[model samples]
Target: MTDPELTELRELAAQGDRDAVDQLVELAGERGDFDELRSLAAAGSSDAVDVLVELAGERGDVAELRRLADAGNQDAAELLAELTDED
Candidate 1:
């Protein structure tokens, strides 16, 4: 997205637009933008958390999974356990 469009979307998201939040999560996931996803998740987007967990799992990023798990994401915790079992 262009800078202006991204900024507008972020503004809408900050204003509690659920659709905007979902769009941002989709964009972040498509770009593999972990920081963006993390920020969205921190702002209470469960969709963002789900995407982050999926991304971490796909990349086999145990540390990221652990961080998400520690942050109280149940899906992340479950995935982390599954990954640990694979070791």
Candidate 2:
């Protein structure tokens, strides 16, 4: 079940409340919502991009990381490099 607080935070984040967006990013990270994080990052949220890159790297999500890197996200590129280096 989704946490009530997260649901509320997501609602506020969707409305473009920066603080709420930041909170949602934190909560999403805690909940391991990689897809949501990726969506937020794609929407141009730098904070979300940071978290998304970290999570993607941790989860070994090469495709997602590659997508972000292709979009010129430096952090994603670095993380993807690190991940690929492990091969």
Candidate 3:
């Protein structure tokens, strides 16, 4: 994608445009737009997951974290452990 397209995508996401989010994800997945996908995940966009799996850096609620961990999110599991330990 060109810089202009990326700028437009970023603006759309910033505005909470769901169609833009879905379109971006589809474009990234189909066109190897990995960097944009990674950016969205890093920004805490829930659109990253097909069904709510935890992204590497997301600090989600404990129960959800545990669920994701059980579904194979190592980082989520680690965060859950750490969060639980502090309780």
Candidate 4:
């Protein structure tokens, strides 16, 4: 993604465009851009939250998962539990 494209997507997303949000989420997930995904999740995108949870779990990022769980993300909580259970 180029800078201008990212900026454009951000602008569209900021304007309540669901398609833009979904596109951003998809791009962020593909790039493993956690910060972008987090921002989208914070903005109330459940798809972003789902992608964040999956990425964190795949990477075995306990801290990230914990943070998301503390933020009331049930999928993160469940993934955290599953990961810890393997210990």
Which candidate, 2 or 4, has the higher TM-score? Answer: 4
Rank the candidate models, highest TM-score first: 4, 1, 2, 3
Where in model 2 is the C-alpha error above 4 Å?
1-4
**Model 4, TM vs. native:** 0.93
Local accuracy of candidate 4 as per-residue lDDT tens digits, 1-87:
799998999999999999999999999999999999999998999999999999999999999999999999898999999999999
The sequence of per-residue lDDT tens digits that candidate 1 reaches over residues 13-72 is: 999999999999999999999999999999999899999999999998999999999988
Which candidate has the highest TM-score of all? Answer: 4
Q: How high is the lDDT of residue 61 in model 1?
A: 95
Whole-model lDDT, model 2 = 0.82
State each model's CA lDDT, in order. 0.95, 0.82, 0.64, 0.96
Error of 4 at 68 (Å): 1.2
Per-residue error (Å), model 4, residue 20? 0.5
Clash pairs, candidate 4, are: none
The true-versus-predicted C-alpha distance at residue 28 of model 4, in Å, is 0.1
Question: What lDDT score goes with residue 52 in model 4?
Answer: 92
Q: TM-score for all predictions? A: 0.92, 0.79, 0.46, 0.93
Q: Write the per-residue lDDT of candidate 2 for residues 8-75, one digit (tens) a residue.
A: 87788788888988877787788888877877776667888888888888899999899989989898
Candidate 3: Cα lDDT at 39: 64
